[model samples]
Target: MKKLLFLVFALGSSCFLFAQDETVQALKKDAERTIQKDPNDTTSKTWKTGGFVGINAAQGSLSNWAAGGDKFSLAVNGNLSLYAFHKKNKHTWDNTLDINLGYINTTSLGSRKNDDRIDLLSKYGYAIGPKWNVGALFNFRSQLFKGYAYDDDGNRTFNSNFFSPAYVLLSPGVEWKPNNEFSAFISPATVRWTIVKNDSLAAVGAYGVDPGKHSRTEFGAFASLNYMKEINKMFSYKSRMDLYSNYLKNPKNIDVYWTNMINMKLTKFLTLTYSLDLIYDDDVKLFGENNDSPATQIKSMLGLGFLVKF
Candidate 1:
């Protein structure tokens, strides 16, 4: 249902965008006007929309090279981030969607998914003060393709897939938004759903769901912080942190997720991006010598690609 909602909203946004015949020159003029306006004025722009799309690819062929490497290798990665924000008459609505997908093919390892992610966030707030608001926040995250890990015997164990495991979180809370670039939201009443729809996975109780159930619900206290800073036209940074503590279960065992991204525009069309993500869930156990123990998860990526902005 969360995924359905996201797709519906995404489709509506796309139709709305195409319905307007906005030109590149007009957008440039609008950008010029935006630059001239008071940067700190939150109400200066009633509707704001933009996004970045990038693609990176690499290929290598080795012919008896001295350095040991795969005979043939290729990698391709693509990412998109879109945001739409509206602020008027003490009411604000913000929505964002981010997707990343990658694949690698090598003579030794075969083709596999190196990265995959789908994330959506939406929030609506009614102001109570200059920097405080009553709001409801919703977020959904999952992946796109099947994931597996290979062992010495060349047997692959299924780990994840599209919607095989997903997370949906919703909270009605107070938000402290000091400026357009920063916000913190917290609430004691929060509901989170951990979903594992695949029958094979649910049979084994993957992702903390019951052995025969497709989903698990948790009532918890949740807090999140989001911030973005642009040092200059060429450099920018964004980060988000989320924390949750289940009141019905181990209340002291908290779940933490933090992610950061840095972007650099080297030229009109050239760009570089770096992303880091860290996650720790008390209910998730690692697949290792001690499968019962949980461990921190970390992922990082760096890319040089051609970028298009709108």
Candidate 2:
């Protein structure tokens, strides 16, 4: 009778231990599945940030070649772009800042500025529907250094300087965003300011401000369309266009600014880039071919450079 009782007690203990082990294994599997379903559990991220910086250079040297060109030419260009985006449920905010500067040296032209650009844009929106949002947009643009025009005699004439043609725009508008790559905004009411801080340029009424005045203000209606797309693993394109009409002045006359950029990746850190810009403003004047008037302006650049992204 003593042996029988001992065996029964040992068997009961073993069964209890085995049951506990099975329960623990089941719990572990359940926990892993839950983690696999939701990696962050309850927390969600709302911000995304990225940017890229690039530098491009070109150099050419001619000996006794028949083709007529400068004996030696060199150009260097640099550009930077940074952006931040936030989206959580019904609220969204986006910001971008871009800078570009370049210079070129030639036997005849010496050294001169080839490119200059500064641009910033910010927008905040609250979604009211699946595709529409109410938003406020702000934009600022200017150059970082002096720019000049060269005469036939190779004489340089000062045309612009830092803040000489700065532009500031603010608008409260409705935006339509179908996806992450396209957006359109329209505002019936907008305010724009043109600033020429340089005393000499301001005195000349540069960029449409009154002579001797530092700034000009206008109320306008504004519309902008933006698009970006990655065509493949190695190519991408971006474009934006803006239009504005001053309500207080000639509402029939419109101001336009358009920009486009295309990139082709050759390697992880090397890219070929092309950029074009078009601008038209009635208030801005340019002098060329003995004509001094407001005219459409266009610029283009192409280069291959090292690119770093973050």
Q: Write the per-residue lDDT of candidate 1 for residues 48-70, one digit (tens) a residue.
A: 99988988788899998998899
Output the number of the lDDT-best candidate.
Answer: 2
- What value does the lDDT take at residue 136 in candidate 1? 96
Q: Which digits, one per residue and each the tens of the lDDT, describe model 2 over residues 1-310? A: 9999999999999999999999999999888884355655777799999988999999999989898899999999999989899999999999999899999999989999999999999999999999999989999999999999888899988889888889999999999999989999999999999999999989887888889999999999999999988899799888999999999888999999999989899999999999999999988777657536778899899999998879
> Once model 1 is optimally superposed onto the true structure by TM-score, how far is the C-alpha of residue 113 displaced, in angstroms?
0.6
List runs of model 2 lying over 4 Å from the truth: 1-41, 289-291
**Candidate 1 displacement at residue 28 in angstroms:** 28
Off by over 4 Å in 1: 1-45, 152-154
lDDT agreement with native, every candidate: 0.89, 0.92
TM-score for each of the candidates: 0.83, 0.87
Write down the lDDT that model 1 would get: 0.89
Go through the candidates in order and give the C-alpha RMSD of each one to the true structure.
Answer: 18.2, 4.9
Candidate with top TM-score is 2
